[model samples]
Target: MEKISYSRVWDLDKVFIGGSKSSQFLEHMNRLVALVNILESSIKSLITPLSINEVIKVVPLIENIATIRLYLSQANSFITCLLAENPRDQEAATLRGKVAQEESRFEKELSKVKKIFTYTKEDVWESMLETEKLQEYRFILNEWRENADKNLSEAEINLISDLMVDGYHAWGHFYNNLVSSINVNIQINGKEENLSVGQAINLRSHHNEEVRKEAHYVLESIWKEKEELFSKIINNIAGFRIQVNNKRGIKSILEDPLKKNRMKEKTLNTMWTVISKYKQPFSSYLERKAEMIDGTGMKAYNFWAPAIKSNRVITFEEAATLITEYFSQFGSELEGFVRKAFYEGWIETEDRPNKSAISFCAGFPLTGESRVFMTFNGTLLNMLTLVHELGHAFHNHAMKSVNGLNKRYPLSIAETASTFSEMIIFDAAMKKANSREEKIFILDEKLKRSVMNFMNIHSRFLFEQRFYKERNEGIVSANRLNQLMEESINEAYAGSLEQPSIYSWVWTPHYYITQSPFYNFPYTFGYLFALGIYAKAKEKGKDFEKDYLKLLRDSGSMSVEELVMKHLGEDITSEEFWEKGMELCVKDAEEFIELTSS
Candidate 1:
């Protein structure tokens, strides 16, 4: 069994000619802008109650725009990769600016078509859907009309899109840059060193309890200094969104995110209702883990505490073999895809300074390719992240033949495949543990994530809901933000911690993104959704593999509820479906408590 080594950087030439600065890349951008102009011109000339002949003429233009947008997506992925590898790359920064401008222009042009579709009477729109050339795009075209109905006017929508570049999105970028610039000076083993925000935060999971506490205080002090700036950033972001929602005739703040997620409000509410009932098991697990660490119960800092240290550094090759081996039990298709991704230079795993500390998989549906970015530190967590990201890549691969428009699934369903892949690796790790200590360590790790995905994420969801509700009135102050966060944590955790991470909202970047409001709950949604699917896999054995792949493939073509019901034969809009997922975590929590106390 020869172990295959993974590459530190992926090949972008597969998607585009040369690199970002290449003449071919420039040509692609120019052509995309030209296509955008043409599309806008063609759409603006169209009249309402569009005849079938007019639709036929317009459909080709829309398809051309979709093709050009695919090229833009490829270029965007390439620029992000370059920037992620070296944040100081001036070339990458320039290209990112250009790409952003073109994307805004392109989106505005696409909105015009949406406006046309909105104005078209239902019979006319349905008649257009029946056309042979337009039938493939029925899902996308229909969705645009449904969304457009919520807009003020085509002119206003375009104005907002243009303003968002400097007004809305600029705030998000500023927060990112501001956070990146701050460094915490921490003394590790009596030697003081300045650590980036991410490095300092990771220290909370350090094996030494003292180090974890020191890291917590250092991070808290750093955030405290910027609390005022963070407060303004959040308030303004929320304020901008609220204003937009109000003008769009949306009353509830949740309306935008729920719509974006393609999930019913009742479904989200039902999921939370079930989660509230299952918090005690997680609280008990946290308490026991804290008790094992010390006589004291859970402390705010101890939430990230590690199990007994049997730490061993793994190599990239070993991680690949381990992941591929476990993935094979699901099916050889997944095994083969993981192998191809590694061998074909679709994964970037460089461990370097200034590299982004996050991991994401970008799907290039037009090219039938996907790229994964992550720093591999060879820890168990890193291995889990590898498979987790690979899970996302696999999902993208499943949808290779899906229509370009249909490939864009909501965030709630996006995590389904990744979490499913993680379960595979996690179950394998637990089975392979060589000692009682190792088993406890594995269980603790699993319990810790369950606590995070369920309780911690749930707290953020609650905090954001309250923050938006209050922000609707006016601006929320820094002190009030901390109070809201702590209140959410206290209620969600049920006395699991001595105190909450009061300034947690100050650091989390999700709340700052203008494009994706309420980004926290999707994680919980995906985790629970995957758990339900994973349980089905266990019960049905290998028969579940085809159904799982089919679910992933159809993810983009339909809403989350439709995707779930069509494939799994379950209604996601009910408490019964959500309760099954919640029970799995509670069961894990009970097992964790029993093992640790034994």
Candidate 2:
């Protein structure tokens, strides 16, 4: 593990003062705001299809944005972490929501400017479709026009976009509240107490049977109280989706996300079909796991419970060493970056109250830096998460040379590098295990993730598919909503589930999330896509690094199929593509089954 000094690693003098907001942060705020406003106005108000004049006007604005974003990196981190530490603080909460809402408005304003210029004029977009140096930029702009026609009209679009704050997306905020403020009815050791959502959930992994069961009950009861609220949230959002979809001439709600994902319907269908075929292998591992734990009917909540290495804890220093040794086999560049992220204070890992209960990476183009934030209490899984976040940072690092416009890959492919890095680490763990129990545990961990990336995500996609379909028809009732949610789980779990899990209540917030669509499948797509690429990298030996970096640079610039073809010599939107991807997962499940049985 990397023994990183908290003070030196993050350069606290630059970002924060005594764990509070820097006194001078607001002084720099106006310039940043002014820069963003100018860029938004200029980009949106292109009067004549963005000719060379318009294009030139954009370069400086884009450069300014890069600068502002870079400056905001640590500042944003400080504010977000501060808010996470105490979400109930009304002032901070309001500020947090306001920033997001204001950003949303700015984006809309930019879109309006685009609409004024384009406004159903095909030539406006097509005119610059072939521009050199920004060919990828032009491709995406034109593609947006093709999609806009099939979207809602201007006034209606404006209304729906605004309504998202109080309507669909508010539900997610509500869910966040429920999770954040949730307090257990019982106390630990007979003391009056409460659990932060992360700590509460983390307790369920305890080896003590009584604690696990108590945590289990606490989770179910709290979620049950808000189930109806969440249910209505789902119904309302689904109902809205249905109405809007039909008006936009959308054949299915899936169409937009598919296009946005840069995939074809045929490819998605093939991918899910192939993924579902591997359920038996998952079942084999699941049954073995259940037997080993002396449990029956391991349900959804049990999904995260530790089957091995109970109550594990380690220092952040140990985690870094394990991360370095594990990643060194892949290539030097990645290993070095992982090392520096710690030694350089690119990671924020001190445990504190109200810090967000999750870990994420933020990329800054101007500084060419990626910062990760999380509390490191030291566990193997914590180490894995460190690697995972590093995966995101490395992904951003590869694209540092590209213009920011070409660096932000679509959501579907965003998980590729992270998942790839994780697999490399997991494989390293597998090789170093000294006992059958360790092998079983390590392999089971991989299998658990497979269930998540495939089965669980597949269920979410199914739910969205039906929710949108029914919504287009009209508003769905609460009872009807529950049925649809169940059906989605039924289809995805297929025979892998020994019994039905009550996580149907847990899915309420996802339906209300308007930030993206077909959210579930992208994770599956990213994992498989990365796996397919990783397979080739293993075969290519040292020669793959140059191509891999080039591929990352191009992810945001090209369509998914186009990017895959350019880098991997195959089209992603084919049955042949997805089939090859799931092959390794099946092999891993088989290996898991053998080890567990032995």
lDDT of each: 0.80, 0.67
In angstroms, give how far residue 25 of model 1 lies from its true place. 2.4
Q: Count the backbone clashes (under 3 Å) in each candidate.
A: 0, 14
- Segments in model 1 whose C-alpha atoms lie over 4 Å from true places: 1-3, 12-20, 149-151
- Give the per-residue lDDT of model 1 (tens digit) for 432-503: 889778877778777777888878888899999999999988999999999999999988888787756799
For each candidate in turn, the TM-score is: 0.94, 0.86
Task: Output the number of the TM-score-best candidate.
Answer: 1
What lDDT does candidate 2 reach at residue 583?
Answer: 72
Least accurate 10 contiguous residues by lDDT in model 2: 5-14
Global lDDT of model 1: 0.80
* Candidate 2 local lDDT, 103-133, one digit each (tens): 5555555455445545534554455455454
True-structure RMSD for candidate 2: 3.8
Task: Give the residue spans of candidate 2 off by over 4 A.
Answer: 1-29, 36-45, 50-79, 116-129, 149-158, 165-169, 185-193, 236-251, 306-311, 344-355, 373-378, 472-483, 498-500, 504-512
Cand. 2 TM to true fold = 0.86
Where does candidate 1 have its weakest 10-residue lDDT segment?
350-359
